[model samples]
Target chain A: MTGHPQSSMPGQKISIQASQLGKTYEHPAGSVVALRDLSFQVHAGEFFCVLGPSGCGKSTLLHLLSGLESPSTGAVTIKPTSVGMVFQEHALFPWMTLERNLSFILDQQAPAQQAANRQLARRWLQKVGLEKFQHAYPHQVSGGMRQRAAVARSFAVQPALLLMDEPFVHLDYQTRMQLQQMLLTLWQEVGCSVVFVTHDIEEAVLLADRLMIMSRHPGTAKTVLQNDLPRPRHLLDLKTNARFIDLVEQSIGVIRDELQAVD
Target chain B: MRMKDFAIRTLAPLGAFLLWELCSRSGLLDARFFPPPSIILYHLIMISPGEGIFRDIGASLSRIVLGYSAGCGAGIATGMVMGLSRRTRDLLYPLVAMLYPIPKIAVLPLIMLIFGIGEMSKIMVVFIGSFFLVLINTLHGVVGIARIHHQVARVYRISRRAYLRHVVLPGAAPAIFAGLKLAIGYSLVIVVAAEFSGADAGIGYLIWQSWETFSLKSMYAGLFVIALLGALFAYALEWLERRLIPWRDDRDTREHHDA
Candidate 1:
């Protein structure tokens, strides 16, 4: 399914374009296909969520889009100058304190304006509600805090495209919701295109402007669903919305069938 | 909070020393042979600080610093090359395996013949002794870095420098530190042994001289100093490890059944 373009011009609307993206891994058993002939476009400043079962190549697609991994076949082209990524594991540098982790990325930029970079990092940390924990190491913080710090670090770099691979998978329900809201708020504030991968249908419904569901083993996009939910969505309000539940149930049904086929 | 833990931890060493003093005073143990902690301390103090002990410590420490630094530098470089590239790993792994088992100390005479009975021989011995442990540890550390980290760096289009700084170093830190700690310990062992064999100055030389003269108290004092130096070295590495890789402690507890 396709929705109305948010912008009039093609150049303005498209942020990322993937053509026939595919990835295959060689194992002792034989070649395992993760993605095959996957193609999609993510619009600028839009939150796009890829929904799939556990073994599906949803995360693989995210990696390829972020240039983290090379696709065996096909290509992903991004209009953005650079891509920022948040991993499922939080991938926070254990050796660095939260502030230093952000600074490390900032330090990569031309060394002339380090003070400005540090200020930007501090601002990002504050945006993520982690200002108090800036000095804390990743190990010292809670799982949710660590993920928030990871997100903050990614955002501090100001990449035009953000890739999130199940970034909230490790958090408890309440923390996940809080982080989901924070992510949406941050995305709105930054106005950068985001491609988020997740197994949770509710999370996708709550966060994504458009959701793409995929089948497992040799993953391919099965359906793309556009959500007409209003912006500035509250977590409680989304849960109570009938359209949200219907979309979630519909996605869940597709995933269930995909799981059965795999079994 | 941590200070209390530190005090409690010191209790065991204090108790051991107390037991040693009591046993020696009661004549249950030969003070001449074992030397009570107090007597050893007194002997160490009565000896002129500049006579030879300080010189020996200085000489031994310099050799260790030089040898360990060189070995660690080479080991880390070799390890990264082998770990990152399949070709290098294939070429070097077999050679390392073959040489690793050959006790480095066994080649001391050969080393002495080649480098002579000078500081070079002693330093080379320490280098060989330390290099293997560091190399193996570094190799394993680099190899063990999670593939996901590499992917993350790739996603960011991280430059080679950034990749090494962020992905490689942090990922391999725990293993590298483990190897470093082991290499430092091996350095101490080999350096002392090398000194014992032929050194004109060093704590090891002092021990040998005392033994020849049947100065049992002085020998025990030298032995005690050696043990103290070894423990101090190990403790210093542990402190550095804690400071440099704080995350390792947390990761260790989470990954292992025993923290």
Candidate 2:
């Protein structure tokens, strides 16, 4: 499926571009293809998500975008700015406290600005409602709290792009909803392009400006979905909104069709 | 820890000592081999002012301290090299596996033969004992760190220095500390065994001399000193671990301890 330049901010400057991307892993027995001929572009400040069934290579796609894994074919190009990422696991440095976790990113700043980074870390922690736990180690906080810190850590770096692989999948339903809203709020504030990958149709509908539906293993894009859901979407309200419901039904239909085809 | 917890911690040792004292006094157990706690205490007090015990302890301490630090420093460096590279680990694994299993004491003769029957020999035995344990544990520690962490470092473009100081070291800390504590425990055993045949002034030699003359009190004194040192060292290590690895989640008790 081809993706036309979807609506983003007025300028719509490109943040990341992935063209004909593919990845294959070689084991002792044989090489297994994870993704193939995948192509997508994320506009600056766009909240994009990849939705797929299990074993659909969504993670491999995100990893390739993040440059964590190299694709056997094609390439991903990002704007000249530091990239930020979040994972299913909170991924906070276990030894550092919430404050330091954020500051560790901002430490890339000039030595003169370093003192400000510590204060900036505390401010970011405050934005996540974790100011009280700023000094607490990741292990010392709740799983939800740690994820909040992880989100804070990512956004604190002020990246031009953010890549997340099912960042809230490990969280409970309630915490997941809370984090999703908090993530949206942070995105609005940071104005960075995001590529969030998840298997959950409702999650993609809730968060994505444009959703890429991926086919089963060795994943290729099945379709590019335009989410018409309005901004500041609270889960409770989104559950009842007509547009949100329509987006969900459409996403489920696309994925259901892909899964049936796999069988 | 509360007073109750402290009391509970000390209960077993105190109870055992009391029971031993009672058994010796009542003649249920022979007093010759298993002297009462009071007799050992009395002998320890009498020997406190003497230079012999101090000199012996100093000799053993110097050897252990020198050897253990050297071994652990080298072990950590080697472990990092092996852990970071598959090639290095593959090259070194068989060599380590071959040397690690032979009891460190069993090779004391070989060490003494190479280094000579001097302080170097005693220290080498301790070094050999601690080095392999630290190396293996450190390698495992580095390997055990989740790959996601390394990815995070790369994604964020963390500096090489920051990556090592913050992510790599801290991630591997608990395992490294475990290795260190284990090495200390092994060092005590290896040192004593090394001194058994060597010409010298060490706690092990003191124990050997007392054994030959049938100086039961002095022999017990030597044993008591080693035991005391072991207990102190263990407690010190635990305290240090708590300080260094305060973030360590006692996995089993995480739920219970969560605020």
Candidate 3:
């Protein structure tokens, strides 16, 4: 389901670099620290997953990267352009059909080149196996299908950096696996960089080229694991590998300990 | 199944009309004051299409259309400003609160003095009555749009115009439509009342004239016309709702079907 070759290749080295990034919320009582002096780098064409316990500001990091919120301190920079984000909730415009949602991103581009944009969107929709459901409204489709459409929309613009915040957290296990496979296929086809934030250790280990686990609230990077798994990985084969399960268990263990310490 | 549901709905009205006719004919009711459906229908049929009655219907319909459109437009505009801006809310809330409690009909005489006893006065009365309800509802609707949706729009880097077009309007549409539906009912009621008091050519005027002439059947005919018009307007809005917000209907259908 691959389309034409990349129009322009991304740069080598760090595509996105964050240094001393921090976010604090000022409440009526006082300030609550969400992230403090957090720094990370995502290379171009890499699947980087940020895994942590709930309330660990993993989503906060993603939000900062997505330009949804400003950091309290420090800076984050990406070479090419702003990042495209996929929310945990499939933030599809409920007013629009799936095709129209994709068209919206393309429409934001130059108007005179719309025919080309439409063709690009159609290619991406087919890449996600949503060609049959292009005319369907978001509400009319299943949750997994909606998320796939969301992915298609985010990638349709060929963003330099893609940020996903626990996008498959709400789906059933089977649907989540299927979508994970679809996502990998799309990423391979497009060669776009992704910064996915998830609480699921299995999801993190299965999809990420490099997985970074975060500590408790006022989050900081505890460990960064570079997954040396082979490319064009199959989900079923990846699951059967002992190394995959070991990685998942180790990350889950870290998260559980963090939860207990918080309690 | 659909036909069965339709028949079941029609049964109640049909039975009530039959009972009314039977009661009037059996001398169980005062026929002078309480004319049966048969007499009302007779007068309705007897009234010529080109006669003054149709002209009265036209006048009443026109006044309602004008007043309701004005009220809805002004109300939505003002309400959006008030709801979206803290300064506007502070400036207008006190005045709205003070005026909301006063029955619009209570100021009919004052309105007549200001706008005169012509159509202007009646339409002004209707507008005032309808506007406040629509404004308050629309304000609440605007205020009720989830903050999270605005955040999503911000993340997308949607331009201000695109944000309003894609997010705010759709998010607030259900509430706005709800308000409009209520405002439509208010307009129908107020317009008739205003027409009843002074207008010379409206359904309400015809009703008053019939009452003066002691023609109960003709009065009931006018009342019937008013009811039909009100129901028609409501149905029309519902049709618009189905068309404009089809997603809402689809969501509801899927939810119930899944359940």
Candidate 4:
């Protein structure tokens, strides 16, 4: 358990550390365990991937890490900074326009000036290539555009650790790849630690600096694989890169073994 | 296309009214009971300062304004409180449930006895009717907001006041508008009914007195006025709803709900 958040070992370049973390939801029939003794560390400025199958509590882990839900057991320590998250559903406030969504977060994170936030929100939208659709409501635009705005809103705050829960799972193949590249570019620019959870091995392998593979049924980290692929990885370049292919295959094997062990 | 649509809408209703007038004038319909439109129009045109028609309309409208405002205000406040806190919902929900189902008109006799045959009695009936409708809808609006939205607010560190203003209020607005619209029609009905029994100074009284005095044209005139008022109120509320919630789309994906 953590004694104090800031007084912890943040000086050691650990962006976030979760030790002996577990979560059990209390229901009418019985209590369902979602996470069990899941321990991991995301270093400062690292792209950490939590790869697991559906129902493996990858989302619950993200929730726990983001301080949305408290762990039933153990503790999560992080350098105190406003955390930003992207959900599978985009989770942009549907009522708010694209610009307002970014500005809403900016207002809370950077309470400088209204005009400054407006300019910053516009800049963020421009970065996501959504400047033209700044006044458009979430449903007014296409799904990809909405997700991009969501991404912009998350990054607008300039978070210390960004948590993504299968953020591109709903997009079409082309959009998904395009967004994956966009995410890499943004991550490269911001240099923030990211804990991305996804079921797709290829996506995890493509994005993660270190992939943490989780076993199913009350998810626990089975193994953590280091991605030795070279930096500034383009999706097109990654396709021909033998190391990328190898990492995907390696992560797939680990996931397959995890699924097999349970059966 | 828009002009054609407007023409069609206006012409269809005009055609029906014309047919009714023709039928009544041609002796196919009873003019005594179902008076022709032209005579009702004449009676409406004849309305003036001395005729007490304006006073009746004024009496009815003031009751609606006072009661509906207070009722909707109380309902929304209570609903928002209940929506945000489970403890408040647990405490107030059953009380609301028990109280809401009882028809306000049914309590007219009781209210008249307590509040007396005055403005308070009339206004109170409308208030009760409006309060329940708005409260329930506002509660549904708040509770129905996606769990993910709440999580978004927390994860982004949205302050409680800001969350309520930006999320909860707007989130519940469509449903609250639905409730407000229902309450308008209900308020009109309750006011008219309350006036029917105890008052001598409303559209209801005008209609009732005209009937007793065998002034069928005036009675028809009262009915016509009520119809016009109903349309006016509905349109006003609809306009307000459109202004407040610009993103109320029928075809919006279910994943992202009402603003």
Model 2: residue A222 alpha-carbon error in angstroms: 0.5
Error of 4 at B84 (Å): 1.1
Task: Name every residue pair that clashes in candidate 2.
Answer: none
Candidate number with greatest DockQ? 2
Of 1 and 4, which scores higher on lDDT? Answer: 4
Worst 10 residues of 3 chain A by lDDT: A1-10
Predicted structure 2: lDDT:
0.85
lDDT for model 3 comes to 0.82
Candidate 4 structure quality by residue, lDDT tens digits, B150-170: 989999888888899999998
Tens-place lDDT digits, model 1, residues B1-259: 8999889989998899999999998999987777788887887878625446788878888899999999988888888888889999999999999998888789999999999999999989888878888889889999998777677566656689878877787788788888888888788888877888888987778777888988777777777777888888889988998888776666656544321
DockQ of 3: 0.55
**lDDT (Cα, tens digit) per residue for candidate 3, span A1-263:** 01111122356467677878889999999988888777777888889999987878998898888777899998988775856778887488877888877776677664568788778778888988989988888888888888898888888887878889999999999999999998898888878889999988889999998888888657777777879778889998999898888888777776676767664
Which ten-residue region of model 1 chain A has the weakest summed lDDT? A1-10
Instruction: Tell me the TM-score of each prediction against the true structure.
Output: 0.89, 0.95, 0.92, 0.94
Identify the leading candidate in terms of TM-score.
2
Clash number by candidate, in order: 0, 0, 0, 1
Q: Candidate 1 vs. truth: CA RMSD?
A: 3.5
Error of 1 at A84 (Å): 1.7
iRMS, candidate 1, in Å: value is: 3.3
Judged by whole-model lDDT over C-alpha atoms, candidate 1 comes out at 0.83
Deviating ranges (above 4 Å) for candidate 2: A2-11, A109-112, A261-263, B47-51, B249-252, B255-259
Model 3 ranges with Cα > 4 A deviation = A1-12, B1-9, B48-51
